[model samples]
Target: MDDESWALSPNARKPLPELIEDKIRALITNGTFRAGDRLPTEPELAQKMAVARSSLRTALQRLQLQGVVEVMRGRGWYVRSTDVAERDEPLRFDRRVSDSDLLEVRIALETTAASLAALRASQGELDDIAKLAKLHQAASVNDKDELLRTDEDFHAAVVRASHNELLDQLYRSLVPQLRSYRRNSYSSAEVHVRSANDHNQVSWFLRRRDEAGARAAMTTHLLGLYNDLAAQTGMPVEERAGLTNYALEDEPSWQQNR
Candidate 1:
């Protein structure tokens, strides 16, 4: 907002408040307003848009309610990296990253990616995802390495099906950390059950083209993983009741369609 050259369009026929909200949403989606980036002060943005501060605040409040941005009292508003509120210390960029932090990033990335994939994936893409899930499900858990590799492949296929190049690149960059988590997760039998059930459910959701269900499946999968990792390290695991409902229904699409 502060001299950032984000001036609102002057010719819009829509309501001023709505126009302001659209502009902000566009800026955030286009990467101009990044996670944790403080917005321009109310006066500055109002001047830039040539709108009253009251209208601007209304637009911002709408964004806030939508979880697109957050307002910090006495400090100002900032864009959220994820749909949920961010931690006081956002994930760091340095190499000293924790496993829990990497899992957080994975949840944020994969959940949205799955939602988009359910809506946009081609039939062939869904086939690829189903094939990968089958491979993971059929693999021998005793061969931990193979099981883990197939699990990673299934997740990679899901990410590819999302068709978001930037998100794909970011997911690829997190491979090392993901591999670390996978290695630890494979040691537990419960983890294998969680992965198989969740991956199968994910593939089923994709075939059904259920965006919300797909996102929920991926979130549940990763949260299960987070729990597995936490238990291994003796940390308290998160409650799982909310996002853990779906499973591979009898004769899921993957099996019926195959």
Candidate 2:
């Protein structure tokens, strides 16, 4: 719970660019800079942050690739969007998710939520869903973290309204892992905006008592997600599969395929 806590490395820490990129990204997401705002001049920023210009430049360049910034002809780099970090998470790079596997995970939860939300959601719960959806549209510093949390809660409210205490309890328990995996897989504003739209639709239909629509909407949304992940097959991992070079005797060859 300590504000200063961080996971320490046992060996050489990650490269300077990666560390700088992470911190800068957190700042951008936290709204230290707004979209279209210019960043500090490279040399001045490097001096102020006590970092090498090379490292800072590398960090800025990485952000540029994610559409987080742009280098103008006469002007320096400017923030393109803060939600870029959501798209830049591990999902795309952490070995592509299989569409089939992703679908199964989604079907297991969202489908059930749809059915339950149609019958049991309270008026107050419906209002809460709307509030969360509105909050998610905000990306300012005070609202950014709340935006993420609210988005998660919007889906969770569906489970609660479903009126199945067991289902609700199960979802509540799995929420953290589900959220982490979902974010880890596709944590970008692109997905975030889509999810917000989906949440609103699901909530709308459920409020209308459109049972089939609610179920169908949630299931369809999840299926589309699975398909998107599937399209990313063969995304490259950073490390090479050279385990054989360090393999101990008696190790099986099957592990080398990675």
Candidate 3:
């Protein structure tokens, strides 16, 4: 493969890791790499692609998550599959599933996960959750990628703390789509601050083992995002009216005992 030829475009708006992912995927599509082929070592690929090793690792991880590649311990990354139709499945799913649909799924899964985490998380798990939450809160508002990465980490930590392997797997499956949604949805510093605050609130509840409070906080966080996405997409008022109704009727009860 001609690594230099895969260099990212100067005008691209996607994050460096995502751009690198695209380049690697293009390599696969063009038959430069094939199933079971060992990719160049991380250092070589990083230098050739003009990306940091960390960014390259991130791209490789995302590809692994999408079933396009895999990493062999002490060996190197390898192309796991090169079926164009199979690789495009996620993109097709994304196009069919709207942001609101994703958020609704998140609300269901994460709220329950948060509740379980509050009840089941060990001291060490709780500490990890708190640490990730703090990292997210302290992330620079000017750095969207940092904010997004931290945000994803915090949520994943909470899900892991739930100690439910099945839930963790399901959440991991949505990660690539969630990453894309977060990238496009972070429109301002205010939104970042709001998210950080919500995370803090959720962390606090988890620390106290307050299941209801944790569930409520996660629900509120996701619903707020849902409302924002609905507005941005110009969703019909009738369709959006339920969001307002749910918040008005249920959110306060959750917070009242917090």
> What TM-score does prediction 1 earn?
0.55
Estimate TM-scores for all models.
Answer: 0.55, 0.47, 0.66
lDDT tens readout by residue for model 3, 1-258: 555686886655799888888888988998999999999999999889988998998888777666678655457889978964555434345256766777777777898899999999999879878887888889988877788877877887788789886786577667777677787778888998899999999999999999878988998898888778878889876676333225445332321111
Q: Per the 3 Å backbone cut-off, how many clashing residue pairs does candidate 1 have? A: 0
Write down the lDDT that model 1 would get: 0.72
In model 2, the Cα lDDT at residue 116 comes to: 72
Best by TM-score: 3
99-137, model 1: which lDDT tens digit per residue?
A: 766777788889989989999999978987888788888
Clashes of each: 0, 6, 0
Comparing 2 with 3 on TM-score, the higher-scoring candidate is: 3
How do all the candidates rank in terms of lDDT, highest first? 3, 1, 2
Full-model lDDT for every candidate: 0.72, 0.61, 0.79
Which segments of candidate 2 are over 4 A away from where they belong? 1-103, 139-147, 185-188, 233-258
lDDT winner between candidates 1 and 3: 3
Candidate number with greatest lDDT: 3
